[model samples]
Target chain A: AQSVSQHNHHVILSEAASLELGCNYSYGGTVNLFWYVQYPGQHLQLLLKYFSGDPLVKGIKGFEAEFIKSKFSFNLRKPSVQWSDTAEYFCAVEAAGNKLTFGGGTRVLVKP
Target chain B: DTAVSQTPKYLVTQMGNDKSIKCEQNLGHDTMYWYKQDSKKFLKIMFSYNNKELIINETVPNRFSPKSPDKAHLNLHINSLELGDSAVYFCASSRVTDRFGTEAFFGQGTRLTVV
Candidate 1:
């Protein structure tokens, strides 16, 4: 069974500040990475994904994640964040022929 | 229309009671999953079914069972629930072909409270 780890359980920053969240997964084979965001009282929405090809993957809402296979990491980043970016962010990894595993989410509280 | 939907968004029941949560996906996906989100926001996969067949059973207890009547509907049933079962349950679906970017579409989640 694969597992995921998120370095930070909670993060706080002001609007217009850059943000980055660390994510690491344990899987020895090919894996697909994803970042999902859940707003207050809402469902999880896909923020970004990395399957193959280029290591850097761009997603909706100016979110981007880079897949570093050597480090077994797929970190989410945004150049500038807004107050609306306050939410719980989850990092997930899916190995071939396995169930998707999620990391302990990071709660981002972006103050305006 | 909602891509994935779960019924009874909020459920509160006694410790010994049994409850069921229903989930359906209109996206025509072949895979569906049940995940639990604890109070601290930790998410873990409980069960997964692909094309109406059980695929992943992530070491979850037998007290929780997942039933898929068809490809689009997967329901979770909990028997003799305990206080530790109080958490948010989310239903998600994805395509087997990775056509949907292999990203699971999630429902609004059912917040279960065992009193």
Candidate 2:
């Protein structure tokens, strides 16, 4: 069984502020990590993913995440966030068998 | 064009009613999945199908059955829906890899409300 834990349940920030969402997973063997964001009324879209090779992965909208294998963490970061960045972010992990287990999610509110 | 789409974006039904949610993906991926998002925004996998074959089925109730007619379509049917079944159901597709899919594409999600 695999599980994902998102440290923050909700986050509030103003425009131009730095944002980081912590995510940790419990799984043995190789794993694939991903970050997905769901805006107000939109579907879940892939923000970034880490399969192999590079530890740092860049995503759309100036977002990025670093997969720290030692820490078992894949944290999402944005150097500076905009009002449009307000949304619910989810961290998912797939250890094997094409099953993706998701975290509780972090709701981010960016004020203009 | 929408890569992944689910029909009945919003479904409001009553207890004891049987309902179904349809999902379709045009990306030609080999695997499709159904996930449920609860009130607390916790997402959990319900089922997964690869090439129209059931690959994974989580420990959900027997009332919930997933049907994959083809590689591109995966449908979920719930019999005798309960209040607990009210949640957003999302469909996703991906190409299966050795460990898993490299990336999964998700649908808009069907907000199911049982009143």
Candidate 3:
């Protein structure tokens, strides 16, 4: 069974602070990784994804993720976060023809 | 335009009753899925359909069933819902592209409360 782990359950930071959410998977295969964000009272939307090629992938809303295959980790990061970045972030991974397995989400609260 | 949508944004029902969550996608994607988010905010895959065919069925109980009437619609029907079945159910869809960069578009989840 493939599972994802998000180390940070909740993070609070002031505006312009750098953000980094750690994510690790327990799978060793051709895996596809994704990051999804859910704003207050909104549906989950894709932030970024990494299948192959470049390890660092950029997404909407100034979000970026790096897939480190050696470490079995795909961590989300932002150089400067805004108050509007407050939301729940989810890290998901899926194998071929398999369902996407999500990690326990991390709630981020950015104070302005 | 909303690409993916789910009906009954909030469902409050009694135990032993039957309930269904409807999902429709207008993105013309070939794959759709149902996911459950528990109190702890842990997301779990319940079922997945591709091209109107059941593809992935996790270790979900038999009480839960997913039906796909067409390529763009997938509905979940729960029989004899129990108190433990309370959770936010989300529907999502993705294209069949071989690349892994494609992301799944999720619907506004249906929050079901069993009392």
Computed on alpha carbons, the lDDT of every model, listed in order, comes to 0.83, 0.83, 0.83
**Worst ten-residue run, lDDT, model 2 chain B?**
B95-104
Residue A71 alpha-carbon offset, candidate 3, angstroms: 0.4
Q: Global lDDT for candidate 1? A: 0.83
Query: What lDDT tens digits, residue by residue, belong to model 1 across residues B67-96?
Result: 999999999999999999988888987652
What digit string (tens of lDDT, one per residue) describes model 1 on residues A1-112? 7989999987889999999999999999999888988665344667887879999999999999999999999999999999888887889887875546677678788887
Off by over 4 Å in 3: B1-115
For model 1, what is the error of residue A33's alpha carbon versus the real structure, in angstroms, after optimal superposition? 0.7
Q: After superposition, how far is residue A108 of candidate 2 from its true place, in Å?
A: 0.1
lDDT of 2 by residue, B12-107 (tens): 999999999999999998888898865434466788888898877889999999999999999999999999998888898766333211435677
lDDT of 2 by residue, A1-112 (tens): 7788999987888899999999999986798888988665334667888889999999999999999998999999999999888777889887754356677678788888
Model 1 segments more than 4 A misplaced: B1-115
DockQ of each: 0.04, 0.04, 0.05
Native contacts present in candidate 1, fraction:
0.00
Q: Give the range where candidate 3 chain A is weakest over 10 consecutive residues by summed lDDT.
A: A37-46
- Which docking category, incorrect, acceptable, medium or high, applies to candidate 2? incorrect
CAPRI band for model 3: incorrect
Worst 10 residues of 3 chain B by lDDT: B95-104
